[model samples]
Target: MNTAPHSLRPLGCLKAGLRQARQQRALLCRQMATTTSSTISSSSQTAPDHGFYKITDPKTQRLRSAFAVYSPSAIATSPSALAPLIQPSTSSNPSGALARLIVSPASPDPLPALHQVQIKRMDPTGARTALFAKTRHAARVGDVLMVTHRRGGEPFAGVCISIRRAGIDTAILLRNHMGKVGVEMWYKIYNKNVAGIEIVKRRAKRARRARLTYMRQAKHDMGSVSDIVFAWKKTRKVMTTRGGGGGGQRLVVVLRRRRRRGSRSREMREGVGERRGRGEGGVDGNRLCSCYLFC
Candidate 1:
């Protein structure tokens, strides 16, 4: 009973369709507006957050910025922006440079030294005498020294002693113009130019020194018992053998072995030329003699 006419139904359907189309169009318009707003927001710049970047006042008008993000690969960046990122070996570095590595080299110290040394020994005879050093400044063994003596308290000349050793004080000496070393033959001038005992002791005390051997030799004269004896035996031997003309020739050989000192007693002072008795045998300034035994 209430059903519409067939023609009216078609007209209602059309109205309903029109209303749905209007609602769809309105919804589409709202969607387009939202999309446009989103697009604009995405394209524009936003305010920086404290986590992303830092701001700095370089100086007057100069301002700078840097990124705080820590990523291994992110370090390959611009110089000004990346400078603050570098770290130093110590915590004190505010600028953050690599820091210098300083070091030093090594060295050595120093020492002291010496002057001269003697190789051989020389006769102590001339040593005390200033003449000793003067004669042989740098004396070596085998050197010769003139021998002298006193005859009847008179100065006699002789040439004896050849150097054997070279030392600071004592040295080995041979007598008789190149004789072999023997007791009297190898006599040592403990102090050449040797002075009397009293004088030596006095000088030593005056100088407040240990020894006056040097002082004595310097002032006193030198003579040896060996020189006298050697000459003594030589002269006598000449008298007995060559008689008078024997002076020009060297003395006869001395059988330095110990023999009888006198014809009567078996006394002795028989040195090198034991062949004859003590009269003239050694190299002392005065020398031993065979005269008493022979005559």
Candidate 2:
């Protein structure tokens, strides 16, 4: 027996032994280099094929996916990493780095935000009064509206009262067809019986005051008989009181009121020959007169 170490015990044996030891060391080094830890780590985590989660690195520049999931712990470490890419996540957001690392981002979504709504059929003829009810019969402030009233088969026109937003439906003020501007009226969705409940295309926002515009235009275009007497009264009040004007404005107002009212009071009594159901006209008529007087 030779007194050599086991590796060098024999020429063939020693060579084989040394080669085996060398190979084992190389294998151990390779294994160490590939491992995330001292032990083998699983590759079944959320991440892109490139191995990064949340696409923080984004392998390349364009948006990676619709959304990236992240780990809260790992995410906190690189809190500002996503700032340039998208809107800042809220403090309550759970998206983070590790979460991204664990799961692949989702595909980008293409969704529309708002859609147009349509009114299929509304008693178009009665739209004026209906619109008035909706607008609370406010003044025709900004622009004028155009309407088409069908007297027999021919269409006519006029201006409108104010238009306001009432819940989802738009409310508008319309001068009564009876030539009483003080008789502004309204029509709810359910009550469109004038001609037919057919809503024409929505108005192009020519003026911010769609209601008033429509009222003004409708009288001309639709040829609806207008009751702008109340409107005139209201305008005269503002011009007389708010700004510097001649006493003539007051005289004009009083004289105009006396002439119109004196003649109108008799007309009103004759026109409203019978009082409508208490709640239906009493309260509303009062409101109409008040709007004519003040607002």
Candidate 3:
């Protein structure tokens, strides 16, 4: 037997001790991190993982989830009340209905000052005699329209900032910005002074205000990409299991009272002779007794 002093232990023992110490230290650190993380997660409110704060209303003390402030019920019906908001207001009876027309040059070749093309009216009503014919689809505010001048020159293209559809003197307020300067021109559809008018782009389905003067003042047309990302985070759905099998169904089983194990074994032991009489085991009483003992 080779005996070594505790101080002069084998290299393997020293390695094992160091390994155990390291494992203990690692476990202690993991426990501390887990406790800290749990504390953070248990807080009442934390910033979302997507990195955006929830907007709260100061008055209502509720989250502001919508982009617009006005609700359906709060919409003002009076034109005077909505004038300050720069929203468009039309009369109860509109004048000659608005329509779109293809205002191209009369000639094929493009000129330096003026481009010549034939004009084609795209009104739903088949009326070529009148310039302002009643049509099912009328041009409204926020619609992009192209207006050709009387000299068959380049068309004046802009978005309809406003529309005044009051009787025979109906007119449209077209706004076109040149560099930093903004230019607005009002045109009567029935006037022979204007060559033609064509509807280029329709307004968005989600447009709130009829007069989109607010758009000119806005820095951006739509919300930021971060807003969209944060929106999805705000509207997460609850998780659920999906299947067409018995796995989703929960069943409750009721079990009847069972005989006591000891009582059952004793009964089997006493009935061993009766079982032998019935010729169950062929002349093996000891085997039958052992089986009854384990019953």
Indicate which candidate wins on lDDT. 3
Q: Across residues 1-295, which tens digit of lDDT does each residue of candidate 1 receive?
A: 5565875898989877876675555444323332133332332113212323445444632223362222222222544333333332253342222231111112122111111122122232333323234232322222223233212242221222333332334433432222332222343333333221110000111123222223224243233334544555455553474234552243332222223334623343233235433323432522222121100
lDDT of candidate 3 at residue 52, scale 0 to 100: 33
Candidate with maximal TM-score: 3
| lDDT digits (tens) for residues 1-295 of candidate 3 | 3555655677768777876675565444333331133443332123222213566668955444332222211222444334322321232111211110112123333332221111222222322213233332455566666666676666666777776653345567777664556667788654555566655554555246656777566473222223332332232210011111442231111001112445565564444334334433522532111100000
Candidate 1 Cα errors over 4 Å, as ranges: 1-144, 148-169, 177-184, 192-295
Worst 10 residues of 1 by lDDT: 196-205
Please rank every candidate by lDDT, starting with the best. 3, 2, 1
lDDT of 2 by residue, 85-201 (tens): 233323223344234433544433322111111222333243333444435442233322323333344322223445555432544444434353334554333223333222221
Q: Evaluate candidate 3 by giving its C-alpha RMSD to the native, one decimal.
A: 44.4
Full candidate order by TM-score, most accurate first: 3, 2, 1
- Rate residue 166 of model 3 by lDDT: 39
